[model samples]
Target: MSDSSTDNEASLHQYQDIQYSLKQSNRKTTSLFIERDGSVTVRAPLPYDMAKIESIIEQKRSWIYRNLAEWEDLNRVQVHREFVNGEGFLYLGRNYRLQLVDEQDEALVLKNGRFLLRRDHVDSGMEIFKNFYRTKGLDRINQRLTHFAPKMGVTFGSVRVMELQHRWASCTSKGDLNFHWRCLMAPLAVLDYIIIHELAHRLYRNHDAKFWDAVDKVLPDYQRHVSWLRHNGAGMGL
Candidate 1:
């Protein structure tokens, strides 16, 4: 609960329950958030006083370096995908490179390590790309859902995709499945796990052992996919 400000310095504010550290992230950010569930985070350059930051946390009678060390460990498990040339894009477990090409098609093309799309289709170019991926990705997921849902002893009324800021997927009590379009960036196994997880809710609707057992009945290696999402799913905009 410490706050410090200076006209010639960056503004610094500390919270009592923050579980994060100062970091030099490659992404553009100014505030960090650590979830109450033990996720450490960082906010990039804004305004701050280093001495005040130390003092504020110290007044809590907590170990200064211990918090820093915890942040280091948490950072090791964070995954941030850089929107840069030659960086790999994951779609259904396949890797593709982002390539800007001149074409009237205005769609995504997967060919030979490239995800080619129209270079100047809209004002917000990234939004166009995201939509392209979302459409195609939903098609794939729906196709798989149609194939697997029946086999897994579940039935869903519908499957839809939307732009969600926080969650990857959710299920309605009425048996509809809603998934985040960003899931297009995760591996195929991870995508399946999410779909199955939500579909399982059509029967159980809660995270009890029986629900997990239902999931395991379909995806025996569900734990691996869960860990994969925990470690790498954030890069997919989670």
Candidate 2:
């Protein structure tokens, strides 16, 4: 770990086997989370007490363990990408391999059971792929949200597709929707889940019981999609 991460990591108890990352900010509440990579994090108000934090961790031990187990299971499925010939790419729930060709008007396109790309643009293939998704995601996500928003009782004023570092999608307080272009690679059902998730946030603004209930009303099998994202998210990008 770097010095900054060392600053972030701490122990619940000095003699215990478990370690957690600590982040102190001017937040309203203290929360513990397990990241996709299976690392534990504790976010708290500034100037927190060691004993109080330990007590909270002790109380939520069961929830933490269960979530950690799920994380391990999801992470156990290896998902990675390689920039080479015949490399597989995911688009709308289907896998397509790369087929480099010398003649292509566009930078990239999906055709005949493969992603056709210009041989000269192989060095920039990842960007071309991202642009392909970004271009398609704009229309696809917008259409889906337009179809579902009225039924869900949420209206988004605008939608944008771009690169997101930490989240699949987000809804702004001003009623704008932003989705990561990578989301276009997931199954349509999973994409719906992501859309519903952001839409639900427009109403609740937090992931509480009410938010999940809203999601459940929209997609009853939302957990399956959530699990799919957790397990396969590692491979969604180049």
Candidate 3:
């Protein structure tokens, strides 16, 4: 739960007429983010005044522009997949070509270096692929959480894989974890980074210095995974 901006009740705001979305929470410090879709979001402390929030946003003006530009460049490769034969689908960061078949035991299956899809299932291809990712996401996220929770010295409640449109993962105050099924499209190393990020939230609710310190202890190289996701995330889609 990296405090990646959530759209829930986020109000439209502006600083010097620079439009952005504002999300206020109990966080101690204000932070800015360029979302995967290149939207500007500012997460501010609950008690902060509008003027103060505007000041921070003003301070980071240069950084915001640099990142938004990079986001544009990265998303240029955004994927638009079709259910037809020879179309490619992403699984674990690898692009596997889709092959339509008249007969298959399942709606979709990754077999022999390609994705085989039942031709009749093509109309429901989006849902079928979503189900495939969710099934795989649950298993892999659980396995990684089990392996890392002990190392991070934390216990969690239930874990679920679903459509988390904005963030890759989130955790409840009860310590239950929820991951975006799209996460299954990431490489193993990036998936682990997302796991550790949310699990660290069990120890600290905010992305403060101490919270990042916990993540760094486990994954000193985690920044590379972050870069990978920011650069390639747009292509991991239906």
TM-score per candidate, in order? 0.63, 0.73, 0.72
Q: Give the lowest summed-lDDT range of ten residues in model 2.
A: 68-77
Full-model lDDT for every candidate:
0.62, 0.76, 0.80
Write candidate 1's Cα lDDT for 186-214 as tens digits. 78878887788787888796555788788
Error of 2 at 129 (Å): 0.6
* Pairs with backbone N, CA or C atoms under 3 Å apart (clashes), candidate 3: 1-198
lDDT at position 66, candidate 2: 35
Residue-level error in angstroms, candidate 2, position 184:
1.2
Alpha-carbon deviation at 151 in model 3, angstroms: 0.2
Q: Rank the candidates by lDDT, best first.
A: 3, 2, 1
lDDT (10s digit) by residue, model 3, range 1-238: 2244444457776676456887776668888777756688888775546777788888987556434432333234656788998988888878899999999898899999999999999999999999999998888889999999999999999999997645677789999999888789989998998899889999998665787789899999977777787667767777
Of the pair 1 and 2, which is ahead by TM-score?
2
Alpha-carbon deviation at 230 in model 1, angstroms: 0.2
- Going through the candidates in the order shown, the clash numbers are 6, 0, 1
